[model samples]
Target chain A: MAHEEPINYYEYLRPNKKYPNVWCSGCGIGVVMGSLIRAIDRIGLDKNDVAVVSGIGCTGRMPVYMDFNTMHTTHGRALAFATGLKISRPKLHVIVVMGDGDAMAIGGNHFLHACRRNIDMTAIVVNNWIYGMTGGQYSPTTPLNARATTAPYGNVEQAMPICEVAAAAGASYVARTTVYHATEMDKFLEAAIRKHGFSVVETVSYCHTTFGRLNKRGGVVDMMRWLKDNSVGQIAAQKLDEEEKAAKIVRGVVCDVEKPEYLDLYQQVIDRAMEAK
Target chain B: MTETGSAENQAAQPVAPGTVSETPAKKKGPRGKVTVFGTWCKGCGICVAFCPTGVLSLDENGHPYVEFAEKCSACHWCDTHCPDLAIIVEPIE
Candidate 1:
């Protein structure tokens, strides 16, 4: 079910406010927001029935700008709050936005459990590879040997793969796409939201103001070009040798499996209890 | 700079293939005009960099201006992909 009206991005943003949003010029977070709006619009979801939740970060500020029902929750607790909202409302379309650090570091447990529970919700994890809001601190997804404010010399740890972790944690649907692939992102997001069980979309973005500057990755255009050149779709990546694939960010749907959603199972429990009473 | 607003003035010059760089195989039919909302745009140059056709160009201040509205092809690549959500590619009937 899609809207017959032509898509207008302005219709999704907060009325008469959040102009020139808090994101730095050329930030990828806004690209994700645009894709989200397009996906929701294409899916024909009413604004009032959708609840956008976000944890504290550059990405967290998203809910504040969107016109839909939104909650700006504590750092790393977006998924936790969203879980409660989803369970209680059950009918409201829930979407969670989190930064790399927020999802993989402080909120790591909640993220894993949310996936394991197979809750019906969409989580858009903006993986910018650093704690951009906190001034370029090295995040869990920062590539090995990348320079961050915390890892000035270099990061000793390998970057955590978000799609792989989500797939392993039992998320029914998992996909990855970079901001450069805007159309693909829109499609992936729509699919994730339409999935019956928990879905996670890892949006590979860059923190140009913080991460890019620290790493000397040039400017916004350069970063955008880099994303275009470095990312490879799953089908195309399959043809590349191991060494060639190692440097490329493999994108597209990682996994999709049909399964029972948490809410439906919970309804069964409630029905049984009522019958016993 | 003066030819910035008028589509006719900008379209007069036949775009040399070499000068425009790699102009992707143009999709036939349904051309559009690119509109920019200055208030919302942060002038990130995303629309300019990603426009499949050289239909957009950034001014000195970095805001995008429709360079060749005739060649837009209504791709919506710049409009939908613009980070600021400050662009709209309206099809001209």
Candidate 2:
């Protein structure tokens, strides 16, 4: 008789998918994907009822490896595609993944409206600061004075604070963490998925090959260590003065509140129309 | 698989034939078993750098070896943060 292989956590991955996933070695997007899988498993969610959507970029390729209802949509339109999916089948748990450029540049409008509409979906923006897929172009979140292929001298533009924008745009839940803080990332992701309305989890990652090499930041180990030394927790950030806080990446939940979801509100309108008829 | 000897030698040399390298180890451990699927690993070194108890270390070729499997806290940190999903920290019976 043949021996049985014990079930492993990696079963969440598609069985026939090729190994050594598409991301570059030590890319933090993989860590974010891992956190998402762990969060879904912990929630005991049925894979059949979950949908993973992504747009064009390095992070966009994630849904291809995941064993769920997955959609690899066009550039900067992941949330738009997710919106349609959520409206048509409100019961499905929709998760969208996008890179910094995909989310904040091309898809910026969709991102803001998704928050404003209070839709029930979880958006995980894996921000590596530079456009990793298209060969190190400057992204909206690239810190001021950072070097990219486009910004050879230095990036003159200020970086966009993703969590702040999400909160300001009216997302029900907004949280931020880095790839180095994997445990905290898992918790924040789980919370975002469970939240009732639009939620955003910005994972601050590093693009070692493109961004790091261009900037002369060290290898993957050094990049990972940088995340460890630079980031500050939300509460601890409060204690630090302006100068100290400015240098540290603030991590933790920025905002979370109960709100009426867009689909639920639309359903009430449908009921009212039916009554009138 | 279950690595039972000094970890330094294992890091310096490649895995010898006839040693459990392909399948998950069946050892019964108080903490758990740490399995590395060699083929799937990308030699990223994230697991090695972030392991809290110094349980993993990179080999000569950059792949991680279970340097101190006994020290693994079953924290699932290595497995969860692995970019390739190559490591599994399973609690053995």
Candidate 3:
């Protein structure tokens, strides 16, 4: 008989911190964390071989709970740190978790360049629309006309489609899924981790305490139901008219292509220079 | 709580190899056993509200429990949605 290891979710979690996470009662960050853990467990990755890095935000707290090579970097600098770490230790699987503001607003340049560099790293941007940790400020991903603490009347600027931006910047794997589609999010994360080049998985999360209360969205369940109602799979989305499609969040693997990763290319350049010498 | 077995009792059953399956097997036995870690549960009610077959419900204390194990198809909605990682679904032989 084959001896099977017990599947305990807590095994991946930090043993020191007792259960009952610090996030709000209905915050979706925990759900995203669960997806990440499920993905790692599904992939059977050795915890020592994995490194989880995060920028300062509610999402940044994600690494603290996980039993991995966790690093909490400065605000909006997770990608910069993760890039350096990935280049130095190419063997480790690096995952960067950032909130919307961390990824698109403060670290926008780093994010673009990281995708452009095509480095071997997976970025899971937990987009909760509003900056939940430092009070509800309007973020780069906040939908236009939505009410945030910063946007008392309504947000005038359009929301940034993170996957589209990553795809355009040349990320080899780019996918978008909401917290409501937890299974799909897990699969996307697993695929992103397995991919050899830079990958981006934008998890459309909800800040129920801030974004929900400000917008009068009932609660966590209501927010989840709204996600379910508003989202459409990419394939199915292709059939809808422009007007119809505009209202729905396109969820699926947006772009996936094989590309030469930065570290591997750099090594090849060094090898060529040595051969020439 | 009266209807379902404890985690130890459930652990005694044969273990399934992977995370909860997306597709339920067409087997005739009980779909699977779901165990909730009471302390870990934050009373979000996500698992209870989203269980497609209505297999889970919050007890008086707000922790979810398998209210109807027979109806559980092992679809894993509760397993995936539990923000606290409080629930685990295992296949029963």
Candidate 4:
């Protein structure tokens, strides 16, 4: 008997559709997106009850193609918009999508505050370092001295530690995964949705167009292999020195804590107001 | 697919690949230019092969560098995946 491959999430994607996935063939964003969809499926949420929100970037283009109640919002405000949407609806599965540039740079402030608030929402930040949409400009997540359009002389700025930022900002659940870690990513996203408060899933993704070109990284398959080998679990990652851990990717849930979500607190306020009336 | 539309449009467009296919609104600057930085040079040379403009060449240091800043289409193959953190595409601003 021939063995069958396990059911894949990519099957859910609309093949031969109008919205050509602007992402490159092996880009991690697609894998992350598929993992997210699988999370919703695993959680058994109705498609109508899920609202996928996104900011500007190639990752932000995701909501436009999804078959759910999605909103393609302004850059970096995806979490803020989803915050309001979740608080109002209370039953919706709100997911915010953002790219490295939109998440860690222009919309960076929003990201921190969302975690701090412990809002009842899920945030998926695809960190590919450079801005994939508007050519290759260096974003905050771009490694120091890495080349970008604005940083043609070489980026002197430090790359932000996204998972650390989320954990420090008080997110109840935080995790980091790469495009190459598909199984772990789906597992992480599934757990994030089950958590009570804010959750951040940082995906170390790839940009083969600009960052890849400038850096002379190999083709897509090679890029995936690089990500897989470089990644270490967050606990194992901590034991290594910064230089020893140089160019390494870190995956797995770094933080998971229990706290009342913002919506529940809002519900208490609403009940008090109703009693007064 | 009108026959008359073809002859009229051909005069308005350039015959070659780099030639103007459509009359763009911006005033013409120096043609296409690709800028690759040396610091990020893992030296894959995907840019040299992917350059439809055929303007990229390896520097003596073996990292891809472009001298003809005027002859690039800004396609960005060289700027995308330099594994060592070298190279970028920029207009001469």
Candidate 5:
């Protein structure tokens, strides 16, 4: 079968980087990074025109590999730095990458405020249910009964569904997809990148090295299969009864609505001040 | 009966050095080509494990290669899932 020229993913990646990324074998962070790169490529965005910011975690390391204007910020402060960057460089497409612990745990305040402010930026949260970089500690999104290094007897605390939190916090765009659903993740990421206001895309990922081994969840294949078997599209989820839906992760765009963006609204304030002068 | 026992043994045996039987060779199926950039591959086995069709397998060094090109469906799962960006899949012309 004749085919178009295959895309060289390395073109988007840093050329001088050594072989193999820092992520563990079968870690879902790579899949999410690939999807994000593909989405940016699809939109025809110039690498120079994009600013990728990340907090400290496995997810935080993503920007270091990309051939874009990147910044690795302090732990749980990616969005705060991204907000400042977006405000100063309104023309640049700011994308923030954060892990579950970075986004919803210590960074919870920044995450909520970023959503409530409705800034013109894209926030991609990789929810791996555990803090893989910090040695598989239980995170805010780690489900009840899930095993983590910090939660040896299984977590008694409830997990926070990030997409729902984003939606409730007034993000103009919110969606969720797993690494197993690569194509779907690409599409959702593309849409999230295109959204004008605060957009949050929660990528449910797996940390097979730490989380899987501790939980006895097998390897990469088993974890990917679990994601495939457990998640249901939002529309399909609505049709199911409460019990059926309870066990299934609802994927797809949870919320999307147009609203005046933060920076654009901020511009109005400047205009009023000028008029007063 | 002898064939059945041998087949079971083949299946049960751990992946050994220089063994090419990781993915069953399929003669009649959609064919594609998989290219692995050796320098980029981390021997993760993610692409091999997540492949919907058993078209990929890791060599002794843990680098992945297309073991059964004929079984490829051009799903691009391996291409997308490779953490190291080492693998690319394209339909054979």
Candidate 6:
């Protein structure tokens, strides 16, 4: 019966000499990690078949911690590498974990192309708005008038809508969830992975050290509180979209559709070649 | 009497074990023939350590290049946990 209880993440995580996690005490990355591991264990896929890639940022360090096929690629380039991996080996299931700056800024182009191509991969962007890894510099996803290390006087640029971008770029599946919605995160992640083409699951995270303190977001509790207070279902969020309702955050699967997958298409070419010569 | 997320009715379940990605594994064709990719590996042995079927091993640099091929269950632990993002899992067909 106890075995049925969710697997203990802390006990079985990839053994690291760095016992005390480096993230801020309330950082939700730990929770996200726990949920992901449990989901993978349940999916019945051989752990060996899964490749998790990450870009440079706080979240980039996540792959190093996970005991999976992982790569810590250059900042904002995790998707590009993952694209190569998925295309070169269409059989592989490649998932990319990236941060706001890495996925939405310098790596923006690759992210879009992956969606457009509908590459066989899943991208989980941990968006804390500001760049938490580089001491809270203003990022493209940083909200309008938010303070950052670079934006000492508050940011003038409006944050880009990542899920909208994903949808616009033709990601076959697009979902937005938050750390506060731990339950939803797991469900969305599972669905995203199962979806055959490019899937972008944006997980809004908390950055107490930089983004929270500099902006008015307060601490971890405040961030979680925002998630709870602003939570709305997909149906409800859709209604709001019609009525122009605006909440601090919305959580649900935004898009799920069938599209021509890049890797499978490449495999079709191989299939044809075998038949030809 | 039913197990939660126990490989049945997984869709309606609020949370199910998710598909682990990016490790290595072996797949048997209809005849059980297996092929392995030795390069594209960083030699990290998380796969060797996590294989529940006890089917994979490490060559040099801790990469999972050593394989007997026949004993493989195609469990995919090696494919899932290879730190270099190497390894591929597919049927030989």
Candidates 1 onward: DockQ, in order: 0.41, 0.36, 0.30, 0.02, 0.40, 0.02
* Tens-place lDDT digits, model 6, residues A51-135: 8999888888777777778888998899988888877767777989988899989999998888899987889998888888778
Model 5 lDDT per residue over A40-120, tens place:
988889999999999999999899899999999999999999999998899999999999999999899999999999998
Assess every candidate by TM-score: 0.91, 0.89, 0.89, 0.70, 0.89, 0.71
Error of 1 at A14 (Å): 1.1
lDDT of 4 by residue, B1-93 (tens): 587899877643323322322334244543333444443334555455545565666567655556334455444433333322233444332
Q: Rate the local accuracy (lDDT) of all candidates.
A: 0.87, 0.86, 0.86, 0.72, 0.85, 0.70
For residue B5, what is the lDDT in candidate 5?
A: 100
Model 4 chain B scores worst on lDDT over the 10 consecutive residues at B14-23
Q: Which stretches of candidate 1 lie above 4 Å from their native place?
A: A1-6, B1-28
Return the interface RMSD of the candidates, in order shown, one decimal each. Answer: 3.7, 7.7, 5.5, 15.5, 3.4, 12.8
For model 4, the interface Cα RMSD in angstroms equals: 15.5
| Cα lDDT tens digits for candidate 2, A207-245 | 999999999899888999999999999888999999999
Superposed model 6: Cα runs more than 4 Å off: A1-4, A10-12, A238-244, A273-277, B1-93
Off by over 4 Å in 4: A1-16, A275-277, B1-93
Q: Which stretches of candidate 2 lie over 4 Å from their true place?
A: A1-7, B1-30
- Model 1: docking quality category: acceptable
User: Which candidate should be chosen as best, given lDDT against the real structure?
Assistant: 1
Q: Chain A of candidate 2 scores what in TM-score? A: 0.96
- How displaced is residue B76 in candidate 3, in Å? 1.2
Ranking by DockQ: 1, 5, 2, 3, 6, 4
Model 1 has an lDDT value of 0.87
At residue A77, candidate 6 shows an lDDT of 92
